[model samples]
Target: MPTLIRPFGALLLLLLLCPLAFAQPLPGVIASLAERAPWSDPLEALGTLSADESVTLSATVTKTVAEINFADGEQVERGRLLIRLEDGEEQALLRAAEALSAERANVLGRVSQLQDRNLAARADVEDRQAQLDQARAQAQAQQARLANYRIRAPFSGRVGFREVSVGTLVTPGTALVTLDKLDVMKLDFSVPEVFLGRLSPGLALSATSVAFPDEVFSGEIATLGTRIDPVTRNIEVRALIDNPGLRLRPGLLMEVIVQQRLRDTVVVPEAALEPSGDRHYVMVVHEEGDDHRLEQRSVMIGERRHGEVEVLEGLDEGELVVVHGLQLARDGLAVRLLGVMDDHTGVREILEAHR
Candidate 1:
């Protein structure tokens, strides 16, 4: 029994000694000191680009299309004639009404002259004047009916592809074309109710799209939804972006970020975080008497932007945290400083690798 116990003790001692033998200062491990800086938390959300004003042009009355005055995809001014329907019959009727109105006016003039000469009854002159007024009203009504055959642009915008051509019969409410005011773009996005205080009219924001990865569009908040959506607990936000170059289009998907007021906070590289289950930790290096040692510290993280993260708790300014070679880090183990993480490009390269 004593011989067996001695062998087991030796085996246990060897297992313990093996870890000590392998323990050494981890080389090439990048480390950086945390610093307090102005941090502006950005809210990320998906957004959609829309036209400041958009509509599908349609006819208000059934008529045969006689002429198309504007070309497809043309930029038109307000009140420009776009479609002209068959108004020949209406024009003829208007001409007849005008002729009748002219005859009534002549009769009214003669009646008034006769009344002045004491050769007509006052009642006769009054009756003639009434007839003249009715004739003029009838002519005006006919002229208005003739104007209905022409469809004009309601606002200044770029026209879309027309669905109808000349001589096509269109019914009331038939879509003729689409018109969009493209000088300014409207971006619609939503944010959680928790961010309500941060959202307001005139707030600035930046947006990006997959189509234009290098370009960042800027805009200002134009409006906000009156109430929060019960299902999502989010409020809708609308922003207006100027499209001077006509680069942005309606319905484009965009990633939007709204900048908030800045506050002083501790910031660190994202690579330094070691996520374990629901908790997060970072390998921290501390000076103990004559030796520098590694320690694992749990931290409460806040917002993340670019390649950096805001540490809300468990860290202070000027404390070094391991950023690279974290696998080699162990609590209470001695470690060597490879270099400051900021001195080398490793942190940036690591952050951009997945991007």
Candidate 2:
């Protein structure tokens, strides 16, 4: 009976030690130490994209469209003829003016010759010269009137769909088509008046559109408003973006980011942050002798970029933060440090690989 009790006691001891065996330190958790670095404060705002120049092509005179020189949505250079209107009457008037001017010029020359020969009075020569000048003025006016019948592009740009076809009669201000210089884009956005001190021309900016989520466009501030809007207390700002690819169009909405200033601050990998409701926290590794443990730390975060975040407070430089295996981290729980992540690889790639 004593032998049987000894065996039972040994079995009880083995069952009690099993829990301790299973509680050994967790191995290979990705981590990195916090470090101080330059952090740029970014101001974000929404902006609208516009062309460098845009206008609606229209005829100045009411007349039938004699010829359409451009197809719908054609790219044209400056002074390229787009439309020609019927100019029969205007052309006839111009011819008549030219003929009258030539006749007056001849009479003036004859009168001058007669005056030289002492056959005509000086008053008569002066009157003939005045008549010639009047005729020339009328001819110039007629020429200008005839020019209105032809419409040409004022600048190099892409034309929109044609509103009037050949033989279509159009009047002044009639809708013809839109023309826009799309090689360069203008971005207009408003920022709060408080940022006025930091605002200036030539500041670098970056923009992103919802249509192209993965792409970013770079530009610079081109203009600033003189007066702030009283109602919103915001000032308007314009930026010029080069669109050599011709991807951005007028009226496209974009998110604008302006880097205002930079300062040295504590930062950590983005994966170290653990969100709880509206609060953020991180797991800090504590080293004591041969044992490594975790300490739950609440961190105040600031600017974020790429795969890193700025730690405003609650963390010190050189403190190791768990960048992976957050679900297994607990306060005072033993863990094994696999290695330190010193590179700039994004958090998503790390997580994807680990998972």
TM-scores for candidates 1 onward, in order: 0.66, 0.71
- lDDT tens per residue, model 1, 77-187: 999998898888989999999999999999989999999999999999999989989999999999888878888888998998999988899888899989999999999
Q: What is the Cα-based TM-score of model 2?
A: 0.71
- Per-residue lDDT of candidate 2, residues 16-52 (tens digit): 9787866754665778989998777788999999999
lDDT, residue 94, candidate 2: 91
Off by over 4 Å in 2: 1-39, 262-268, 271-302, 310-355
Clashes of each: 0, 0
lDDT of 2: 0.89
Which candidate has the top score in lDDT? 2
Candidate 1 matches the true fold with a TM-score of: 0.66
Tell how far residue 22 is off in model 1, in angstroms.
33
